[model samples]
Target: MSLPLISRAPGSGRRTRRLPLGALFASPYALFLLVVFAVPLGYTVWMSFHRFYFTAPGAEVDAPWVGLSNYRDVFTDPVVQRSFFNIAVFLVINVPLTVLLSLVLASALNSKLPLRSFFRAAYYLPYITASVALVAVWSYLFGTDGLVNHALGGLAPDPSWLVNSSLAMPVVAVFVTWKNLGFFVMLYLAALQSVPGELYESAAVDGAGRVRTFLTVTVPGVRPATTLVTVYAIITGSNLFSEPYLLTGGGGPDHASASPVLVLYQKGIEQAHPDFAAALGVVLVLFVVALSLVARRFTEKKEG
Candidate 1:
């Protein structure tokens, strides 16, 4: 009689494993990112170490490797230095303004207020509007003969909002804050909803006033959202390009309103210094990353 056939686990002897359905479904997005982001990022890093220049199709050019010379040049460049400073100022104003206003507006909207839906839509309208259109309206409003100047009359600065070197970046910062406020408000709104109603009841039970309750309950409750908003504001503020580009006319008035990205465009695309621009882009990325980390740390720090 033959020995009893031994039953084994399914696929126990197989040399290969079947791909997970989740991975299979994710492959398209993975491939897309590899092609679009990874490849280009790799090429940029490679170019940053060389003296790269554009050449016509089928043309060969000597791209000498320069190690960190590109980086050194980027640091020494005055335009880049000024751009960094400008971005710092922008962040200083934009980050706090955005966070505070968004949180306050969200709190008000979250309360029993009249026309709540209409106000939410009204606030969000600017965020969804085309930047080009917004810039045009802003230009008109802040121009030498614009409504803002018209309203200010004799109180307006001598050089107007967009032209003054000291005011240009600040104006850009404010404009960005106003434009993106609704999105951050939405984030806070979601965070606020997630907060336990019990906390509010307890706070009220303790005789906490509105402001006290908000500080004790609402603010701490949305810590995660605050961190998110802070980091996002920093990143977006650092990469500011279009607002300054269109609003300040390509970072005019001695490049006072210029951002690192705007400078990168000027160097990389406009000036045809792709290698140098690549280096600048790399540095900007590092800077933004550093700033984001610092912001996250500050926001997420435990109260001692």
Candidate 2:
């Protein structure tokens, strides 16, 4: 017997499984992270637990598992300690200077000033320029016999800027701030443009001057951007390598300006201690994460 056909509403009775558009769109980036970051990070962690070293193709290798010995050694190493200390000094100088300069420059650029576009481009030129070229120019300008010394004469330091232990890291900090300032200033400019015109008008109505308006309205309005800038500054400051590497000549002058990344390269590639280098890398990642979190929390609290 033929069964009577029953009329069913569309998409009724049977469940229609729809593709997740969000995940579908995000899969490419997910795959990229898996290949680029996650896999390498997992391998680094695995290496950190073993005394691993590179070997010839098809060669039998014995990578003994060393547990936390690498971490212990990293902590005890004096050079590593000095590298961290140097980084701390760099951050102390770099972060504030970068933030202050970026805000000031961004504010100025945002105003109705003559040649605003020219000044903006001029400031941003150093940021987009090659780091090697910039460092070469900086070295020429700051060398003992360079124009700066010639201009200063006897007032120049006895050992010069990059050569002096006390001056080297600070010099690197300044160089980094100057090099990266344009990028940060761009960020601040975006943030500044978003601030409402009414706030400035209100401040003016209340007899607030430019300086007071900046402190009271402009600064507060850019709190979110401040958080972003601070976190970025800390992360970049912690990963400091290029400036010290190039400007200081591979963290030279007795390693006075050696950063953790530079030290990691020296240990891993130069000294063939991949295990120790992995440990240092892990520690540096953790340190940067912690600092970023602390900075975010501090800024968020102030924002609240």
Candidate 3:
């Protein structure tokens, strides 16, 4: 019998095989990831465990070992606790409101109605507008004597929306929801479109009313989109920074609206405590990971 072509010599097989030529094509991107993402992440982790700071404005390297002291301080710090509380309140309020309103707006837009396209574009316009410009417009409307107060018609006093500690975080959450609503609406609209028209027709043939059809057909059909929207809303709501920062500077009249990112900014850039900021950033990443895991569990459960 002829020797089997599949057989390999033991020593010959031990020799390393060359990487595919496709890896040559991927080299640049791999290098970019290593340089841009991996290196910085590694450096941040290294810095997080040490007392690191620039000796001068241009200095790049000066860190003394501090072990887990920064992390310990991060957990014990009152400002950090306040920041977490602020993010918690924002997430609790913003996520549900955003998801619900977006679903409604998407369903409305998906319907055959007059001026639907115009309304879609109009709603999406806020999402495309510059953040600073949006903030300025919101600030104008929320001014003590401005349109919102004027619209109230003396039903209530014109409270300072951005200045009041209790109201500031809620206002920020609302602004975030409004700004991002259109994006989520677009997501749901796409999901709604993907739902088969046959399903709706069948529901109608079965004597199902609009509400019944919606709950049984429409909602379940878009479950994936709902999960995506919920997870996205959670991440964005938890990481809210710019709205609060621009609306009410320096943590909003008693650290009322301070997000973890704002705390990182204050510690790293403002106070020259990069090590502590790195630790805070790591903690925030862990928080996001844990929340995302819980969300994933719920999503998978619903799917099951």
Candidate 4:
């Protein structure tokens, strides 16, 4: 006779419930993730350590091994240095501008106004459009005979917004800010709405004006929203490939506006050097991760 089911010793492992193996069987997706993302990332790391050229595969001779030489070369390369410099310039001008503009616009939209909904839609219209198409429109708008300069009535020369190294990158930043600000503003507006009216009422009774209440009360109240906007800005800003690629068209003249991502693309595609490209990818990851950490540290919360 078989032993009774409850007769097993409780101290033994037999009493513990066994989970269904069917759940573990799961989807092919789990294996796919392990294969696709995990494998590629590992391969990229390995490739970054080696100097791989396409010709190396065809040549029966031993390919030269280069360990971290590509990374060392990137650090010393003037072109690479300038690309980072360009990114710095962009961030210096746009980061604050973007955050501030979004906050101000969001507050304004939260205010009572005529055709408020219509205006919100109008402002957000650019964001929904295709990036490339909007960028094309931006190119024309800032062109010599474009509407903006024409509207200025020759007050400012319509400098080549897409061609000039000094002005082109800044213009890209402004364009990016313009398009992106709407989404951020909506985010802030929602946050603002969530703030209690009682706090504003109490602040008003305490003789605080709109600006004062906003500075002391509203801003402190929306600290989390501020944190969100800031991190979003840094993350989006690092992925500066599309703007540089389309606006400057492969880093512009003399590689003036070569974003890090753009350089990675050029290395892999134009130069056909996957090894160097992988090195750039690793560098790009470090840059993004560093920026994220910096942003997190900057937005560190204090407990009262």
- Among these predicted structures, which one has the highest TM-score? 1
lDDT of 4: 0.74
What is candidate 4's TM-score against the reference? 0.80
Candidate 2 weakest lDDT stretch, 10 residues:
1-10
lDDT of each: 0.84, 0.83, 0.80, 0.74
Best by lDDT: 1
What are the per-residue Cα lDDT tens digits for candidate 1 across 81-156? Answer: 9987886788789878988999999988888887988999999999999989999999999999999988998998
Between candidates 2 and 3, the one scoring higher on lDDT is 2
Candidate 1 ranges with C-alpha deviation above 4 Å: 1-28, 112-114, 289-304
RMSD of each: 9.8, 10.4, 9.0, 9.6
lDDT of 4 by residue, 98-121 (tens): 778877888888878999999799
Sort the predicted structures by lDDT, highest score first.
1, 2, 3, 4
Please list all clashing residue pairs in model 4, or write none if there are none.
none
- Per-residue lDDT tens digits of candidate 2, residues 109-191? 88789998898899899999988898899898888788988999889998999888889888888888899888878878877
**Better candidate number, 2 or 3, judged by TM-score:** 2
Task: Judging by TM-score, tell me the better candidate of 1 and 4.
Answer: 1
